[model samples]
Target: MKKVLIMIGNIALYLGVFYALLYLLRSTYNYEATQNFAKFLDVNPAMFMVVLFTLITLVYLIIFRIKGWIWPQEDKNLFRAAGFRRLSASRVLLMIALGLAGSLFSIGLIVIDDIAKQFPSIPALVDDLIRGDSIWYVILGAGLIGPAFEEILFRGLIFRELRRVMPVYAALVLQAGAYAYFQPSAALSVISIGSGLIYGVLYLRTGSLWAPILVQNTAMSTIFLFKYIGFYEWFGRLGDIWLYIITALCLIALIGGSVYVWRTSGNGGIGEQANGSTKGGLTV
Candidate 1:
């Protein structure tokens, strides 16, 4: 119940920002103004994403402090005294394999028109990036920028906090669902959330942020690479039967491979609750 309340507030907080951002991009800023702003800033969505997410995190932290919520306890020590990292090497490999599998699985999601759509302007952003000289946008935005905001906020802040009130598994599942909602992709939403759920498990088991970061870096970079190379259209065309068929087959093969790996090598691989209050049992 506490997590639910936090989820509601967190959703509202982010949703309000999202709508404001939407309005700014659409009604407030005209095309020329938008372009001009993009030009002025090199229009790297990645950089913008970093700033936006960082601000959101800061705001969340502030809310936590004001409400006497003790989260993200400043354990600068964790970084300082690195003990034997517990992340299993086998699990790491499995996660990488799954990352690729997940991307292919998401291709099946393109079967629907609405599911084919991306974050507003993402397609255009891709094209503009191709025609323009915004190298920073592609590299910084996709690789470092987007992940920092989304993962840190959702996985680090929200999921960690939820652990205070619920079982780690429960919090992980809820965050995955929340992540799917955020992406709003058709079939891809499942992939996003499912893979996210696994990452959450890894984070829990490893007791550090590094596990999820590694997985996230791989996933985000691949997506950026797809967009960077102009192959997103092909993936987006998953609406056709052939694409779906091919994707499904590919997923089957990947799963088979993963199962084979698991059997042969042994072992399977493996966010936030909410809002400004941060008062609920959340510690980090």
Candidate 2:
């Protein structure tokens, strides 16, 4: 029954949000021309989707709560599934490695994006990502909101549940696939999938949600920082997917190494050693 409710709740959350978003965007304009219509909503589509999910997350949670679902409270032991018990040096290294590997995987998606022009995307999505002349918005989006939304949904909600029906590998892969499907662009599927897998693996190895969020948000903020600092041209750089891929690879290497070391070295203060535990929750 809980699993059935989870499946239903997830479907409703997405469907409701999709309907609402489409309605909001389409009702005031031509539904046929999404590109043309999207101009009116000035936020980054990714962030826009973030906002969308954040809003709908309430609906999701409300539904689950009404049904007596408890989030982050499923398996008592799995909380340490990804080795998140410490703030030690090894934990930090684990986060760095995970971040780097995740970013590198996302970087590879750039090439795939180019080769598959058939994939859908819009200029505004890129604009939203790079248009952060305001540092506060960048900080809020990249630092706080991005991490919170992603961590809660990915680690706290999804991973917490999947350990029951599947092995860690299958759980991670399926969750990654779902994460990719939620991305801003169809072209981003590979990027999202790869990054999601990296994150899931990190969670599996380390057990702490905070470590991955911290590392991911850092990477995200750094990319925005480049835009904030005007290190590259906005919108124009999207066309140069190779450079993005290369830069992503370098950044990934740096961060992934840092995360791995943090996770492994017991003496390090960021995350703790692996423990044999599993936990569950259903916060909708």
Candidate 3:
């Protein structure tokens, strides 16, 4: 509990610094003003994300080393202790495929939104991003930077720390909830929770942050591609029955693919303990 609290406090401090920097830059450079916050973000989403994530990564490294200085560890690899590790070629490919499957599962959220009429309208910022001038920025921010930072924060630090005090499943669910809430849209929040759970499971099975980060990038990139090409709109025009069937199939694929990836990726590798000890493996 103490560890969890400390971790939360550290995360809050980092977020505070990130937003402060963002506001400072916005005021200093005075990014082009717009009526919609979403439009403002779309104008240079890449610049904002690249700067934000770079700062977070730097802050994490500094604090990680500072903690080492305070405690004086013989081992200097705090990043690995936090779950950052190199992934095998096979695992990398499998993770990317799994990410595609996860995106398919996310599509079900659109169906749910249509049925419930509860999903918030897509933000203008997001709409603008899809149609924005700079494809490079979109690719950089959405495809790479966003996934890297989110995985580092949610999977690398938050989940790793929570697992120290609780069961892996409990930690996964708790972190998924937090991930869901962090989303910009309610519809995306619903989908993100599922994505987070799958990513958590992947991290647990591989004992590496790379798996989740890769999966997240692939999934997000696919979504962005669909949006850019109007594929989502075309798909939405399909008959209700077809949509239902596709949603059902996607759900099955998500579960089946997740389990297969877990088994193939070393059959549930041992989870890391807080003090860097090995523990009993978590199997499906």
* Top-TM-score structure, candidate number: 3
Model 3 residue runs over 4 Å out of place are: 1-5, 29-42, 74-78, 107-126, 233-238, 263-270, 273-284
Which window of ten consecutive residues has the lowest lDDT sum in model 1? 273-282
- Whole-model alpha-carbon lDDT for candidate 3: 0.70
User: Which lDDT tens digits does candidate 1 get at residues 1-284?
Assistant: 87668756755765576556545544423576567665544445455555555555555555545444355543222121111123456656655665566555553443335445643333443354333346545656665556645666566656755665777668889888877777644454656676666656655554444555655566556655665665667766545666667667756855565445435532322222122112211112
Q: Model 2 lDDT vs. the true structure?
A: 0.55
TM-score for each model:
0.56, 0.60, 0.79
Top of the candidates by lDDT: 3
Candidate 2 segments exceeding 4 Å error: 1-53, 57-86, 93-124, 233-284
Candidate 3 versus truth, CA RMSD in Å, comes to 5.2
Q: What lDDT is reached at residue 26 by model 3?
A: 58
- Model 1 ranges off by over 4 Å: 1-42, 57-91, 107-132, 184-191, 230-246, 249-284
Model 3 clashing-pair count = 1
Report lDDT (Cα) of residue 43, candidate 3. Answer: 70
